[model samples]
Target: MKTDLYLDMDHLLLLLLLSSGLQAEGSLNQTDFVRLVDGNSLCSGRLEVKSDQSNQSWSSVCEDDFDQQDAEVVCRELGCGAPSVLQGALYGEGEAPMWTKEFQCGGNESALLDCRSSGSDRNTCSPGRAVGLTCSEPVRLVGGDSRCAGTLELKHEGEWRPVGESVDEWTLEEADFACRELDCGSAVSVRRQESSDRSVWSISYDCVQSGSLRECAASDNSSHWLNLTCSDFVRLVDGNSLCSGRLEVKSDQSNQRWSSVCEDDFDQQDAEVVCRELGCGAPSVLQGALYGEGEAPMWTKEFQCGGDESALLDCRSSGSDRNTCSPGRAVGLTCSEPESFRLMGGDSRCAGTLELKHEGEWRPVFDDYPFWILEEADIACRELYCGSAVSMRREESSHRSVWSISYDCVQYGSLRGCAASSYSSTILLSIICSGLLLQPKISASSSMDGVSEAKQQGLLVFRGSDFTVSCSIQPQYPGGSFELRFTSSTSAHTYTQPAVNHSAHFLFPAAEPAHQGSYSCVYHVHVFSHDFSSESRQLSLIVVDPRSDQIINNPSKIIITVVVLILLVSTASYFYFKQKDVTVPPTVGSVDLQHVQSW
Candidate 1:
C-alpha cells in the first residue's frame, strides 16, 4: 500500500508541473495577439488587436471605444508600465481593418481579450481618429524620494538591475532620454556610482536611437552605475498657474501612478517637499478642494515627513493605509514662484536690479514703460517677501536682451504670470525695500567702570557714575538717524540724534535708579523718497547702590551678634530659675506653715 501511495504522489507532481508549463505558454502566446506597430519603440505606436476567431485577423482599435481603462489592460498585456500619453493618430494612420465592438475593460484585466465587449458594433472609424497609445517604458529611478531621482534601474530579462556603464560612455543625452521616458520633465544632472560585486545591465549608444533601454545590448563587466536627478516629478494641475493647483505625486518603481494626496494625510512638511520638488518657493497656502478634486485615485499612504526632506517619498509614512477620503478632501496647494524673478547686485535680498530667469538664463528686467513707478516696485517687493518698496531707479548699462514686464499685468499677479518677451534695452530697473535697512548696534561705557560690549543681559553700574549709551549701524546708505529708546517700570524716555558716521551717543551724567531699564536703538533712514527703519535688540541696564552692597556683605557679623543675644537670654533664664528655686521655696514654706496652723 505504501509503494502505491508513493507512485501516485509522483504522478500528481508531474501533472502539476505540466499544468504550470501550459499556463505560462498560454500567457506568452496571448502577448503575440497584440502589437504596437510602426513606432519608435515596442511600447508606443498604433495599437492593433488581433481576433481569436477561426480565421485570425489583426485590426486597429477605434479611438472612441478605447478609453484609459482599455489602454491600461493593453499596456499591461504588453509587459509595459501604465499608459502615459493617449492621442489620436500619434504614430500614424493605421492601415489594418478597424475593430467593430468596443472593449469594456475593468482596468485590472490581465489581457485585452479578457475584457468584456459592447453588444452593438460601431464599424466606422473617422480619419485622424485611430487610437494611438504610448505606454510608459519599464524604467525607473529607485532608492530616492520622488520618481524623478535616484539610482537608475531598468527592467531587463524579467528583473530590475542598476544600469551600469563606463564613466566616459554616459552623457546628458542618454540621461535626457531616460527622464523623458519616465515623464520626469528633463535631466538636471547625472553621476556615476561605484558598487560592490553585484549584477548590473549596461547599455550602449543604442538606447537613445532605439528609444528602448530594454532592447539595448548589455554588458556585465561594468562596475559603475548611473545615478540621475530630473527636474521635477510632482505637479499642480487645474489651477490658474503652475504654482497653484491640486497636488499629485508619482511614486513607486513597479507601477508608476500620479495619485492625489488627501488633505488629511498631508501637512505643511509634505507641502514643502512638493513645492521644492517643483522648483517653486515656500508653500503659501494649503487648502482642501481649492483647485477641485481631480479624477486621480486617493493616495493610499500618509506621509510623515520632516520639513527638510528633499523629496516627499523620502519621508517616512504611517503603517496604516488610507485609501478613502471624504468628498472635497483632496489637497490643493499654492507655492510662491521664486524661480522666475530675483534681485541681484545689491547689499540685501530686497535691494538690487530686478532680473527674470527664463529658459535657465537670467536677464535684467525692463518695465513696459520707460521707467518703473513705486506701485510696480511695491508689488515686486511683496513677491520677493521683502517689505514695501522704498525707491526705484533706472541705471543705463550696456544694451542687452531684457525681459519686458507689462506694467498692467504685474499690478494684478506675479511677474511670472505676466506676459514677457525679449526686448533690447540699456536701462536696468533697481529698487530698494523698506526691509532693507540693517539693524543698529548698541553699546554701553562708564567713566567709573570699564566699557561693556552690547549684550542682551543686564548691565551693572554704580550710583553717581557717568555712563554713555552708543548706537551705530553699518554704512550702507549715506545718512540716517538713531533714536535711543528707554523704558522703565515708572516712566519712559526717547532721545534722538543725527547719525554721525552711522553712530550716535547718549550721555547719562549720573547713574540713577530710573536709568535701570530696557534700552534699544532704532535706526531711521530716508532714501529712495521713502522712510525705512530697523530696530536693534533690547539691552537691559541694571543700577546698583554701593551702600546697599556693603550692608549685605556684612550679614555674617549681624548673624553672629543675633546668635550671641539668643545664648545670653537662655543662660540668664536658667540661672534666675535656679536662684529662685533655692530662696523662694524656704520663705514661702515658713509663711505658709504659720498661716495654715492659724486657719
Candidate 2:
C-alpha cells in the first residue's frame, strides 16, 4: 500500500542477509522481517483490492502458518505479503552492513522462548500451573531483554502487567516484590491499599526518588535505579514503550552527529556551487555555522562544466572530459571565475554562443566583446592573424547567448604563413620556401702542365701525377655566400663554408691514390630560414689522370669532373692571383729530346 516502506526497508536491509539456510537445528535464519501496523485484520472492508498477483499481501508468522490461510490474509489486506511471517527480515545500518544477533522480540518472529500461546496450542503448557516458574531473580536486565520490564502476574486481576500502584487494590509485599524484580534501589517507602473486586492489581515503584514515591529496590537494593519509569519505558502489553525502532548502539555517534549537522538544511556550499556554475559569482565556500546550530558549513566544489548557472549541476569540467566518466563536481580550495564570449558569424562552429574552455567544458569569458578583441577563441575560430586586433564589437542582435568579440592579427602573409584554428592558436604555418633547389655540379681534373696523350695519358698519368677533383658548385644565387662542403664515400672530407644565400665550391685536396677510383660527393644547404637545412644534389665524379689509361673508361664523368675542376681552378686563380705564370722556348720539329737536351 505504501511504496516508500519497501524502498526504505530495502535500503535498510540490502546490506544484511535476509536469512541463512544453514542447519535447521543450531542455526537460525531470518528469511523475513515483519512489523505491525494498526487496523490490521483478515477482512474485505479493511483491505485494498488489486487484480495483479504482485499486489498480494501477507501477515506476520504470529498470525498464521498455513500457506492458504496466509494467502487469504494477504488477499484481504491487499498487501504483497503477510506481516507476521516477515516479522524479522534481515537488515543492517549504512551502505555496507553486517547482520548481527537473532530477532530480539517476544513475537513469533523472535528467537525468544515462545510463551504467549495457550494450552495445547504449544503442547498444552499452562504457565500458571507450572508453579513458581518465573523470570530470573533481580530482573535488572539490559534494555533489550524481557526482564527489562519486570514480569508479575497479579493475583487480583489475573492479568500480567508491570507492577504499579492503584489506590483501590494493592499490597506492600507485592510492591516490594515489584521493586525486588525491577532491581530498584531500595524499599525507601511503601504504599498499602485495600482490594475487593480483584479485577486488576495495583502496585508502584519509583526508581527516581522525587517525593514520597513508592521507591523499591528490584535488584542491588542499595543502588538507586535512576529516573526509570514503567509506563514510559516498557509496557505490560507490547514492551518497548520508551523506544519502538530496532535497538542500536549510538555507534560512530559523534561523527554521525557532525555529518548530520545541516545535512538537509540550506547548504552554504550551494553558493559555491552557484559560483562555480555561473562563473560571475566567484565566491568561496562560507564555512562555519550558518542559520541554525552547526548548519551549512561548506567546502569548495569544483568542475569545468561552464560558467552558466545551468553549469552548477555538472559545471565542474570542460571539453571531452565532461563527456567521459561523469565529471560530476570537483571540490577544491579555490577556483577562478570563468570569462565569457559570443560569436558573430553564422559559420561559427560551437553551439550558438562562444565559450572559453577550461578543464573540459565552456565557461563565459569576460565579455569585452568588440570587433577585434584579444580573446583566444576569437583568434582561433575566425582563422586570422591579421595581427594586433583591429577593432572589437559586441553583437547586439543576438541575446539567447551572450555577445561575441572578434580579432585580427597583423597580416603575416597568407594563412599558410600564420597558422590558426578555432581551437588552437599556438600553431605556426610559415611555409616560406626560401631554400634554393640546387644541382651541385662538382668536377675534378688533373694534368701534368704539358702532357696530353689520350691513351698514353690515361695509362701513364696515374703513375706520374695523382688525380684530383676540384668540386666547384655554380651559384643558384650567383656569388651567394655558401659553404663548399664535400662528403666522399672513402675520404675524410671537409667544407670551406655553408652556402649562405646559395652557391658553393670546394677544391679537392691536391691529389690522392684513391682519386683514380669513383667517389661520392655531397653538399648540404639550408633550405628554409625557419626550417631545417636541405641536402645537396649529389653528383658522382670519376677522376682520370691526364696520363691515366682509364681516361675513356668513364670519359663523360671525367670530362664533367675536368670541367668542374677547370672552372674551380680558373675561378680560384682569377680571385687569388693576378695571373698564372707561363714560359715559351724555341723548338724545331719537336723530336730532339735525346740529342739536344743532353746539355
Predicted model with the maximum TM-score: 1
TM-score of 2: 0.18
Tell me the deviation in Å of residue 436 in model 1. 1.7
> Per-candidate RMSD vs. true structure?
19.0, 33.9
TM-score, one value per model = 0.50, 0.18
Q: How accurate is candidate 1 locally (lDDT)?
A: 0.74
Query: What is the model-wide C-alpha lDDT for candidate 2?
Result: 0.28
Q: Report the C-alpha lDDT of model 1 over 174-250, residue by residue, as the tens digit.
A: 67568767888545556667777577887774355455877773757666678887756566767655467898877
lDDT of 1 at 370: 39
Q: Can you give the lDDT of residue 385 in candidate 2?
A: 20
